[model samples]
Target chain A: MKTRYHIRPRHNIRPQSCIYALLASISVAVFSLPNAAHAAGTLAGTDIQNVASATFDTAAGPVTIQSNTVTIKVDELLDVTVSSTDPGDVITSPGQTSNVQRFRVSNTGNGDEAFALTATVANGGDDFDPSLQQIVIDANGNGVFDAGVDVVYTAGVNEPVIAPDQNITVFVITSTPAGVVDTNRANVSIVAAAVTGTGAPGTSFANAGQGGGNAVVGPTGAQSSASGFLAVQATSVTLNKTATILDPFGGNRPVPGAIVTYSLVATVAGTGLLNNLVITDPIPVGSQYQPASLTLEATALTDAADADAGNFNGTRISVAAGNVPAGQTRTVTFKVLIP
Target chain B: MKLIIRIMMAFATLTGASLAVAATPLQLSSDVFVERTIEGVDGTKTVVLEKPKMVTPGDSLVFVVKYKNVSATTATNFVVTNPLPPAVAFNGTSDGQEIVSIDGGKNWGFLGDLRVAKEDGATRAAQRSDVTHIKWNLNQPLTAGAEGKLIFRGVVK
Candidate 1:
């Protein structure tokens, strides 16, 4: 948008002067609000000075007198904010180890201060308690976690000291034990507090601020906590076998040279994915092997150990169902003759 | 007794002002204090002013300007002006006759009658944060040895 300024011609002011006035006013309006609304309020140790003046008429002449200046130094505010970095409940399998729930701690105060960190996994409202491992900080300041790079947090040791408006990422490591039912959730929480002190708002710690000024707790009470949970999804597989007999005498009796058909159905359960699932069945003692009779999900397989998932040795049949999703079933059928 | 002593002092000052021919006779002084609410043992709360030792953001402060006329004659056309500190935002004053400046003392008027220029070449109703200075006029003449104080409130930005 273009702005047009109409200057009265009778004022005898030059056009260039008008342009300068316009620019000066525009700059002042744009820069004034941001300087007043700084998020981290005024910096500590800032001296604010004020003076008052008065002018009055005297019998001899007009006179003006100014007052002495009074100065006040700003004190520091101690506040902290903690929030969960994870989008939602983290998905994990039973017996999973070293699963991490992330949280970010920020220093929302106007001073340089150290924060003490604490984590708890044995929360009462959780379905199953996850064993507490250790709390670690993002040592390199990177969002991604590195096993050996990140620093493990210990009480009164290696605490992070952040500047005003700065944040640090923290990870809570825990392990889920076996036997925990599927769809169960375990919550973990972390708390970060100013090492100086924690108390009600306006509570002041004398001479504890960055520049030796008093430190007063802000609205956050100088400490904060955030929670994240882990959801369990267990996986397993089950197989069933059935056999049918057909005799040459047109009877369903167990006779010699009777053809027998065997079917094996494998079904996977739970919400997790099962890996390296293999099914094997040995040939019966009184049965003769039928050539090219092995089929997986109604697909034929050779009697050799080839690139296909199905293979048959002299005495047994095997099918490698690499990965199987939950609620899925696979059937393998083979024919055998009773010699 | 205190009031009598104060009045006697003012008379002595007036005598001295008459002897001096060139002195302006008007004296100004400023002070800042913080207000805190204290609860009494009987469950009554009272606000008390104390020296600001730990001033933080969003804290309320009171600025007082005291003026006195020490000359033998009445002082007329007396005006007091105070420019707010950069780190403080004007909160209001108990006196309704005061005029405020929003453009660094360039213009002055009642707060409700003032307009602030915006960067978009538009004007907006002046707000508390836009106040840059405050002024009060003593409409009546200040007689010899007369004294009074003016006050306004502000908050740390």
Candidate 2:
């Protein structure tokens, strides 16, 4: 039997197999697509270049990190400029004197960042009122002074956002009172956010921000009130002899015609007021009293209120007998002619 | 097998729809902190300029306070209350300034107008010392990382 079996064509297609292949392919595609997108969009670590850093030189040197991340860099420079102009072009006048000071702040940063600016009246004597002063912000970052751009003034508070490489102006004015001294100074500081990098130029890798610059007010009137409390203080008091003849022979060698001068000094302390006060130093029993010629000399005397007891004029007084009010304890410099 | 393929396609489509619905990006970092510092004084606590280290009688002092927004979302309906310490007097302007009695932690308005009967059957109006606290109402919202400061003055003893 020559059996030539009829070769039937095998239908190899299976619905389940097709489905499994399709599902596996779809999963692979979905996972791979995201990986590719992330690789394309994500910034590489090397792309960020920390340029420079700035440090805040405060009364206390470098400040410790208050937070984990530092906010200021040392490489960055902040320019704080101030200018004042009296409305009438004359700073001194009798009428309503309005002086406007313009403060310009600019940041030289490589990236777009926000900065905090703080303006303070530095060591302003009792005369200046920080509360009365006005502070305006030009939100547009323009250097010009414009109406309606006035920002509310708050002492010791940081101003609004300052964009990088941009400038902002702050105006300060004072109304001078009659016969009052109009002197004031302002300090402006820019607190830059911290950047990255070590040993880099201005790279403040530490996230702690830093401050810079001091601005001062221009010319004004004098202080009006003399009622300010005065405290006199002194570092130290010292006594010195201008001329001392050293006796090489050792004994109390009283050389003939040799004159000895005794001087007593009362130093004024910086903390208190030494008003028309009198000072007297008693002569020791061993020292002889020279009544003929008694002289008083003072290094500094601002007013004519000081007067010697006996003499109407403040110069010198003659010592007659019992403790002289003017010459009792004062520094007595006399020429005691040796016998 | 065909059913399995169909199920896989459906799952992918569902995931796609969900992703589309939830595709909001993280706009800000978590570390931003907006802060404000205010300078002011409470009653009884006399802060002197010369000897700021100690509080004394008949002394003028300054009070400083700081406010910060630490939340990820904006903070709204903010209120701060500070009480006048005993033996302290408020300076010139008191507008927008309130007095409180609840130890400076709670808010109170004028206490002089309100009278409460005591156990002795006597009615007494609140005095300055009875002020529970002072409050500042900021109706505006504070955005994330925003800060502010406030200041005031007071005289002691």
Candidate 3:
């Protein structure tokens, strides 16, 4: 956008004096122009700042117009985090460290960043420590720790630069002590700090402002710590079956076709929270589980599989007992017809 | 058929535009952060919530809106509309009444001014549940290098 001014070239009026006033007024006019519409401008959040330059071929000379240069700067927010799905917190058996618990560290920052990785034991709970700790990156992104496939993550220097919103899956490999019991528990944690803008691994920042302008202890949200418990525990669900025979002549006898009621008592005994408890009981070879005779704790349930919470398919009865706490029992009773 | 196809293309373009309009960059992102002061037998200690996966009743949390001048130029006419989470209710004007929006962003006033219609065909005082959304009129320009949080305390419903 260019603005041309005609000066009439008055002999009495000084060219310097007139041009200064004219340029000042033009600057004000350009700035004071009614701001962008609510939908087009701030309301809709579509606004960009840029310095402008104007030149006027007047009696003076081709002069360049200058204003404050608005340098666009965005906040470099770093948010590194680690989360694990150790739902049951099951303990590792002796000579059995194969139970791999996966922990993910993500760089939820605006720019690419390298984070300092560290794993430590947090003391607070009745937990045991892993005899040996190993950290491995999920090479194939399959969330599984394949010994030969996935490579071990070396500490310090050469740490991978995780992009914003990108995360890498990590396996908290642990080995139990020689003597392991059911009552033993262990806790392990992983921490990651931003190494971006910092020269080396041990570089630390003080009074650093995060993305939201909040002064955090670390460099930014760039640092996070997550601890997972590896407890020694197991859940046991007991099922007891019972049957009652009814004959065609109203007599209790096993004939060609008769109804036999079966009762299954499911009990859970464990130290941790058990989840996704799906109980399945297959029908005997001589009889079939009746569809409509299913009752859970005296509550009638649909016979078809997936018909209700408790489903009895053609060959078996399957029920989803979700989140069965420790020392609790669930009873499911249904009838089967002897064919 | 040609006319119908042209109209359909126009409709699709307009729909896409309307959806994109809501996610403009200058828009402020808001989230809930819960913190409580636990009164223990020893003393009182304030614990900052980290990844709040579960919350109990009677617990109060801070609802903050992070505003930034995402655009190259200064962002004027800044106003943030933060909805109270379904499980939480507005406690009061937390920042000394400097930020008050008890009425679905219609008018800025005190809690007493906010009202709701009752079953008796009469207008009555609005309850905590009636606080559908909270609005803050920044009355300031968000220039570059400007980032801040507008916060209010909310109690679990």
Candidate 4:
């Protein structure tokens, strides 16, 4: 900041210097009314403006003594904002490394700031954990991060510094660990704190050099943080079918006029979901589907073509299975008679 | 440093016993997830199993607190308080009867019952955004060897 101002008379006076000191002291009392408790030597936000007027009796009857008003403003102001635009980008397949999300960091405050960066998996509330999470910046200027095309982000001196209003887009790369099941989620958080002050190169949050004229989080204008997560999705399903036949002689045989019972079970092996399921099985050769013999587990349906009962389109049999959830299976059974 | 708290849940069948907090042993853990809808193989609407992952703005997060009675006795009068993260906005709680504190745990009540002082110095009905913390007081004693869960939700700011 333009060196803190102090009252000074042009001439050298013994008792007058003491009075000038009093004036400076009075000015300090005015602005410090509401202490702007900045975090450290990082100054941003509101400026202090004031003027002083003192009236007194002079050589004449009554004269007014008014001193010029001095204003103090922050030059190297500090302000910044960081956010992930994509928010909840997802990646679940294990061993897959990709740029699934993007973040933007901008210097919204006056002057410049070198933002220190960091990333975390989660603060809890996740179904699964992040396998290998990393942060990257678009090194080639292409919105997309091509393999071996982007650069990894590391904190310290020489970090990317942005001027006021200017912003950069960075990517959050993640890989799901092996064996992560469906519904497992990993939350990732990224932080960008402004790095200011002199002795710049090596200075960090600890022993950090003075930044913006004030401290970090010091009664200030802005601080930026970005966070989000990746959730895993892997669905697996299986179907089981069986058949049993009975002959007219009460013996098991595939003979004409014999009734055959068929069962089909649809089950999901792992955490996953299958919707709008329509099961179709062509009618067996030389066999006739008993229209009224269709049963979904226990309930019997009409033999008609429009009801919940199994439908036979002259050659194919179809059944509607709305949705199949993980570990949830539905079975459809019907009887058919040989021609 | 951000802490990833893991809440484990246990289901105990013991019932009919009333115990005090001092007499029962309790365990708690927490996890988060985002809900998403996707297509199903049955030609109907299905869930994508989005799970918890990289979130974007406007995503709703389900915060689940799994609790179990690890001790040999049942417990009651249990209370749990969870503070909202700075980057999150409390849209609502899965426990509708649960009271919420918006003034940093200073005072709490239902959304419709609470009020906030505005910049103009007028106190008006509080909104969901004013929520800061959630409190859960189990209505029933958690029996020994019994496990269950409590859940609330918020959005990533």
What's the i-RMS of each model?
14.7, 32.5, 22.9, 29.8
Instruction: Give the TM-score of each candidate.
Output: 0.82, 0.22, 0.35, 0.38
lDDT of 2 by residue, A1-339 (tens): 221111111111112345434433433233223122211111101010001111111222221111111111111222222233222222322222333445554433322224343334333454332222455565555555565665654544654444333445555543333433222222222222212111222222322222111111101110010111111121222333232332335434556444445454444332223334444344433434334434455222222234433221233323212222221233423323343
Deviation from native of the Cα of residue A242 in model 3, angstroms: 26
Best by TM-score: 1
Candidate 1 on A232-338: residue-level lDDT in tens? 98877789999888899987677898899999999999887888888889999978889899999999999899988888898999998778888999899998999
lDDT assessment of candidate 1: 0.79
- Evaluate model 2: give its lDDT: 0.33
Q: What is candidate 2's lDDT per residue for B49-86, written digit by digit as tens?
A: 44232222233544444465554556454444333332
Q: Summarize candidate 4's per-residue lDDT along A235-275 as a digit string, tens digits.
A: 67677899998889898888887899998888866555666
Among all candidates shown, the one with the greatest DockQ:
1
Q: Candidate 3 residues B81-143, lDDT tens each?
A: 443433345675556444334443455555667676666789887665456455555666667
Model 4, residue A313: distance off in Å is 2.8
* Model 1 chain B lDDT-worst window of ten: B1-10
Quote the positional error of residue A209 for candidate 2 in Å: 9.0
Question: What does the lDDT read for residue A154 in candidate 3?
Answer: 83
Write model 3 residue lDDT over A34-88, tens digit each, in one string. Answer: 2211110110000111121122232333322221222111223445677875676
Query: Over the stretch B1-157, how does candidate 4's per-residue lDDT look in tens digits?
Result: 0010100100010110122223325555556666665557877876443454223334466666666767666555455556554334577766587777777567777779998777788988888777766766566766778777767776643
- Candidate 2 chain B weakest ten by summed lDDT: B25-34
Ranking by lDDT: 1, 4, 3, 2
Candidate 3's displacement at residue A99, Å, is 3.6
Model 2 chain A scores worst on lDDT over the 10 consecutive residues at A42-51
